[model samples]
Target: MSTITVDLNSKVVPAAQKIWIVHPGRNRSHIDTFESAGVVFLEFPALALRPEIIADDSLLRQRIRYSTAVKANKGFVRDDGTPIHIADYPTAADTDVSVHLRTVKHLTTRMMAGDLVIVPGRGAGGAVLFGEVAGSFFPQKSIRAAGLPFADTPVREVNWLTKRSKLELPAHLVKFFEKPPAIAEVGRDRWSEGFFDFAYDAYSTDARSWVSLDAPQYDGSDILSLVPPAELLALAVSLYRAMEQRADLTGLDYDQIIARFYDHDALAEAQMRFQSPGRYNLKDKDAKLAKWINGFVALALAGALSACSNGDHIEFTNKQAPNDPANAELTAMINMAGQSAGGAVLTKAETQAQHAQSKLGMSAPATVR
Candidate 1:
């Protein structure tokens, strides 16, 4: 296979952007209940007023009056507006009006514009939903206007990007979210970072081409486009796997490695491409390894190019076997490009020396012979 030359000018988007993982509902009733409604439900049952009562202004005022009266009487009011002693309710603490109000405020304030909210499947089986926060917090009254059922509750309007689409999370990733958080800020760490790109590509769109090198036209030549989103993410996965296998490769942490290779633009592009219909087949181990090497080369080249333009030394550490055939070729290409471009390149030995020097300053007791 011919080595695919990616255009360095191609815009890449970072995947490190903020992501909010939210459970659709607290329980089964809240989960998968919005499938037909085409909405993601976020329930706050603490706000104990029925939708119909909240919908009617007059009735809503009366309910508030009844609630105030019950609170003064140190009692409870059933959904029918019938006053009853607080001791009659099993989960009376959860029905505290103040507690409910605080929860609503907290959720609304934390969620902001441009945040991507991921709703994982309810129970063991349900479709995951990805929605962009189109609007800020509003009462369920506003949500009812959008034809949603919930009322007298607080809700943040979302423009559901994936409607009725089911996404199957990889086993590893599923385990990552096994302990569901009421709200999880994802993509900020290395382990959870790749998920956004994966999710976006799997359910986002049908277009396979990410960045086209050739002009837009019907040409007899094969169109040169950047690697498919799935492949790109797979390449990252491979690289991460390699790093995990070889501890001597680089001194940088996972986040640092991502910062150096997968810049903001590259990450953004990967996230956007996730919506494409193309899938990365993992069955072909050899082919996947080749792609992984190509991805490494691409990232190395990007680092070299940046160094060349900025007049800085580019460093890369290769801990693969000295006889590894692919390693020699990749090292040669990187060196040649860096030299031809008048950029300084650091060898593996040099990188090791630097690592040693940094460690030398550490305050460790002398080894007892």
Candidate 2:
């Protein structure tokens, strides 16, 4: 049986004082009021803006005008009073641009850093959405409605915590839902602690929880320190070579080899890097490129191990294992080194040396070394 290790230090600790719960929509009468007055509330699904457009005042004004027209069902008009139909502005979608812009402006200008906005869960026992305002308000194209008309929206850069997992309120914190406020601040008291504890517990118990992986677990920190790419590549290559040469390791299962090598940390770290949105600049561009390179190294090593497998057993024969060629995904990851991202690759000599060192029970040298 494989033993699972939990890193207590890596668990996410929620801050209650920064938390605020928001009701997604107003009463039906209120929505009707806005609609009757030719005002679009644009509260459904929530509006997320692009960064580039937010910075440009002139561009933002134009987008707002178009967006407002779309929301109001009034055709857009050029500054020179020429009517621009919705078909003419294929970039604008059904988003309420005015509300999105105003909301983004309010969030960026009025909200403090580290503030968290919580969107209530739909239906009974459903999960709520938690969005942490990571940065100031900015205008950018919407990923949710990309390549469609009216795609531009105002968005505050947010680190959404509950994007993947749904969280239920703990039994103790259920009272807050009794009279859920349209927008209420969650204090750093017992209720807040209970809520986070419930969230953490829910996250831990989920089948898709990241905590089960052995890599440096995500603690919602902006800065993440990771192993260097070159060093990681060397380790992966060395592991591949070791698996290739070991006669005693034949017929062992993949899990057995993984346990023996005890390098899941590297594997997990790599998986996180490769999978993380920040690595692809989907979130923050400067989230640390080192992590991405480290991910590539992890992928290479994991691929090398995977390539040696024949069905349920690991084939350690030299004929079967030359490089990690069997894994197309791994090959693609290694090829990333040649791409614009510029990750490191291990030389044959260096790989051999590292393999020899591993055979002698020596740890791989640090990146700096």
Candidate 3:
């Protein structure tokens, strides 16, 4: 929910394109092939997941579940006593693995021309390289190794879009470089008009200011806008709860514990558990995913509170958020808003969103009036 400073007033809006973060390797072993061949590729799990099985999501998931899981009976037998094919193991139950599976599937089937790609610094170095997926996915059989784990694997052709290295990466996108997936979509919420415009045509940011939370609009801020209505409601509930917890704490207690909790959920038990990050719904068990989501939720709730407060303050408004949060995770969000906004606390904002409340199985606050 933290507002960005992308060129919000551009006369022409760029088409919303799918953005992907791809890591060439742990040590960037495939950087050469990725650039020279003008392509990006995914690492295959098993030799059995060929074009046929990999093409089907259901089959892939089932195959992964079997393949990654331990089989008590040994040597791959099915629940129905039929011999399970080694190649067709179900996709693993792990979210990252599932996402990785989708990456493989997406590059082959979902990725299309003009879709954007961000090759990590490890592959491109100090600056990230932005490219456009330009051609079809290559699933040619590679005899060099089984399951295509080498430099030459399944690939999708790309055309480098930006000629100059983007040294000053947008802050929101820096996290991806630190802990990237072999393949994962950049959540629509995180898309930046500044980055997109720059990647596309070298749009300048000389005239814009860092959009404050209280700004009347943040149109190109895809993260908040693209969030599903139901999830947004859930996020709202989490924010109100966080506000309450911060309210009761005094001075150091508020600063050290309450504020710190929501501000850095990754350091604690990250309460927000969404999947595929920015786009999908909750998945509590994914530790890495939880860490990312809670941290993001903290920022979002903080930003929202800050925004809803009076304009011109550009900092926490002078009111303390009245309602308490479920834990420190929520408090950090509230404190971040309050501390930054000159100590302005957010009023409790519960909901009449019966559908969302019913689905989430939690009480919501009334609107902050």
Candidate 4:
């Protein structure tokens, strides 16, 4: 791993022209070490969460409260003007469904990928989400064929094989409450994987290629020029549900998964759930971990705002495994911002936040499992 170091000194590169240097990885020779201006270089890693696939169609139907089939129904005019009817939503029959979920996300004063935003509840239907939402939540589905033996190819090949796809129009319209042939694309570029990029096409003349990308569905090499409205809604709902579900998964299993990805001091406590270790109950462990993460987010936000200002430059370099208990990416971003423009815009919002926090008991909201 290469370390990233930023020289804030005015001599090396004027504070106004500070350069963030990163020693490129062996395989990443093309990546630059510095940027010249506005929003120069960015890298948002793709996240492929293993969602608890709700394949049980019956359960899904029950979750959505689908009783009447509504093959054909009639309605009467209301007192004022509108028409009212007790009819089943056409999407109730769809094998896939996406429900809009509203919740609060916890973000630090610094910018980081995969920051755990708090959603309100837990369990099935605690926070209803859609099918596209589920797919987008854990969008990174590994292509098994590419990873199999005999292919000592390259990471680029593996990367290329990891393209993302979406559902067709008719099915999407029924599910996401949108018209047929809608544009649906969101987040970052799946090809290179940066930030989420979503575009809409409910009002496009050409419904075929609403999103501007090379389309394989059509012939050889026709670039996307239009995006369908339904497709866009499906993409949005899928992303929303994926995020909501991810926030709700806080358990021994989740902790174990986190430990597998990055080691933490809490690993021993998490591992005890499997063996006859001590009287370490998984529930308490889960609560403590959740509380820990919550506090870390609070502290990081507070610290980052205290350090940075606008127009300041910060560099994030990997060092010794990922450590910054609060989440390395987050901490690095906070540190970077702190070294620059006297904290971010949130510093100004602190007063309003304090008022809200005081009204709400000042205790950080607990994440639902």
Estimate TM-scores for all models: 0.39, 0.32, 0.40, 0.17
lDDT of each: 0.38, 0.35, 0.43, 0.22
The clash count for each model shown is: 17, 15, 35, 40
User: lDDT tens digits, residues 289-366, model 4?
Assistant: 322323222332233223333433333221321222323343344444333213332353343334323332222221
Per-residue CA lDDT of candidate 1, range 1-369, in tens? 112232222112233335776665545354444434434433432234455544544443344444444444444454677755423333222333444333343355656765676667654555677666666555443233122232333456666655323344556555544544455666555345445444332111111212211112222233223223223334344333443343232454433433444423222232211222322222112212322333333443233232422434332222322233433343344434333323222232123223322322111110101
Q: Show model 4 residue runs off by greater than 4 Å.
A: 1-297, 300-304, 308-326, 344-346, 365-369
Question: Which residue ranges in model 3 land beyond 4 Å of their true spot?
Answer: 1-14, 45-51, 62-96, 123-125, 141-152, 163-166, 188-191, 202-369
RMSD per model, one decimal:
17.2, 18.1, 19.5, 27.6
Q: lDDT tens digits, residues 1-369, model 2?
A: 121111122122323236555444443222222222322122322233345655654455455555655544432445668765534443443443544554544444555555655555444545455555665544342322222234333334455544321333445555554433344556755335444432221111111111111222323442323323234433443344333343244444333433454333332223233232212111111221222222323323333322212112222111212232223332333333222111222333234334423332122101110
> What's the residue-level lDDT of 63 in candidate 2?
55
Please report the candidate that would top lDDT against the real structure.
Answer: 3
TM-score of 3: 0.40
TM-score attained by model 1: 0.39
Ranking by lDDT: 3, 1, 2, 4
Q: Cα RMSD for candidate 2? A: 18.1
Global local distance difference test of model 4: 0.22
Worst 10 residues of 2 by lDDT: 360-369
lDDT of 3 by residue, 198-269 (tens): 353211122221110111122333444433333443443343444445443334322243344343232222
Per-residue lDDT for 163 in model 2? Answer: 32
Error of 2 at 143 (Å): 4.6
